[model samples]
Target: GIKGAFRTRIAYVVQTNGGQFPYELRVSDYDGYNQFVVHRSPQPLMSPAWSPDGSKLAYVTFESGRSALVIQTLANGAVRQVASFPRHNGAPAFSPDGS
Candidate 1:
């Protein structure tokens, strides 16, 4: 069976220059190949976090015109916004049990 860190990919973010108007969150192999986008928005994205089992990602995005936390499931391209309030939301992390 696959074991250790190499068995899973890594997560990162890529930002374009001024006026590009959007940013992207990416996932790629640890060796820096097979890169692909996990999220994109015209506002901003920050605090990207990967699930303990590498099956999902939790991050902050300004897609709604305010900071909001979003969780994306890699297996089927499912996304759901969460932890949003009237002001700001960010710094998302998964519990040890992947809850």
Candidate 2:
């Protein structure tokens, strides 16, 4: 027997200007509904990439005079710093194996 299921969902991250704090990361649907903020820091955030499993996201944040790579989970809103460098660390791309 063959069993299958169908699911329709879409998500995207948006960046907005930051006054005294850093930029904000917002997620919305394809039809531009259910808009909500995901992350916000004292530094600018950019390049939000979703994981292959759609369970996590990798992005960059500039707070310590440099940019740092951070991975955030969408389930419980847990974030972890993955990598950091002395210079800019923007544009995070996930691998094929989801690393």
Candidate 3:
């Protein structure tokens, strides 16, 4: 069996057919319990990546009419902008050390 599987958690994205925030980022335990929406946006959300320590999540968003990268702190639901390039930006992932 996988080590520490019982404590594993996961993050995912869900797109609604129509809603104020059509894109939703969600998280849940390995067994699907304790599920909740982590973030929501009117634009598309993709690449849900958890920090190595599991305290934060990083993802791509187009909320500004341009693709950008953002990091969200799970504890306080605080979001910080990481990058927003001229044309586009995407695919956010934390370094091995969660930097």
Candidate 4:
């Protein structure tokens, strides 16, 4: 089994200057190898939180021209909008049991 902080994975964002997709949510090993994009959009993305089982990620995206919360399943690259409201939505996090 994987143990220790050094073996854990990390999620982060990258700004791609002058690209079709300007913002990217990516995952990588603790040492920064095997990096890959989990999601990308012309709009901004922020606050990536991993599920308890590490099967999904909850984040905020501005694709709708306003902040919205979404969840992405890692296995199939499926995304679903979880929350959308007036003004702003940000700082997504998963519950301890991922419910």
Candidate 5:
């Protein structure tokens, strides 16, 4: 019951505009339909990885001028800033256990 709540479909971020200063993170079905924007930032998005069960996305972004790691839940569009350092933070990956 709880597990199925967020298991709608597979998701990944798509960037248009030639991956320039303005980029968009879009999520869609594995078949490239039912697409929607998960996040958008002026900076680039890097190191997007899915959780173990494929329900959440963990990614790195430069939206704050400095690199920061963010984890977003795909179901309700809830976002949390997980890692933010003084200078740099990038290349985020989720643990096998989804921690």
Candidate 6:
């Protein structure tokens, strides 16, 4: 037998430094509590997407004059560099198989 527990969670993307130039990724509770930064970059970071299970996040970062895709796990706070393009790589979406 399996019992499904109900929980409330909220996810958002925040831009650091007031979105001046270099932006960042942030997530928090539904009531705007427990706010935390998920990803940050001195150059710029944008377009954050959550995994199907909500256990990980995928985002793009521009730090080396190019954009790169990075996936971060919410459990242990581990990040994995997935892809990087020469010009720009933005907006990452996770597949059904968690890829």
lDDT of 6 by residue, 13-90 (tens): 555555445566777766777878776667767777878777888888776678889899988889888998677788
Model 3, range 1-99, lDDT digits (tens) per residue? 333322688888999899799899999998889899999899899998888778899999899889989999999999999999898787787777679
Per-residue alpha-carbon lDDT of model 4 for 1-99, expressed as tens digits?
534322488889999887899999999998899899999899999999888788898899999999999999988999999999999898888777677
**Over the stretch 1-99, how does candidate 2's per-residue lDDT look in tens digits?**
322111223434444565665467766665657767788777668888877777777888776567899988988999999889776777897785679
Comparing 2 with 5 on lDDT, the higher-scoring candidate is: 5
Task: Residues 28-68, candidate 5: write the lDDT tens digits.
Answer: 66667788888887777877777777778888888888899
TM-score of each: 0.84, 0.76, 0.88, 0.91, 0.72, 0.75
By lDDT, who's the top model here? Answer: 4
What shift in Å separates residue 45 of candidate 2 from its native position after superposition? 0.6
Model 5: residue 28 alpha-carbon error in angstroms: 2.1
Ten contiguous residues minimizing lDDT sum, candidate 1 = 1-10
- Candidate 6's C-alpha runs over 4 A off are 1-7, 18-22
TM-score-based ranking: 4, 3, 1, 2, 6, 5
lDDT of 1 by residue, 1-99 (tens): 435333567787778776655598989998889999887768888988888778888999888888889999988979899778988786898887777
Alpha carbon lDDT at 76, candidate 4: 98
Reference-based lDDT, residue 81, model 3: 93
Residue 88 lDDT, candidate 2, scale 0-100: 71
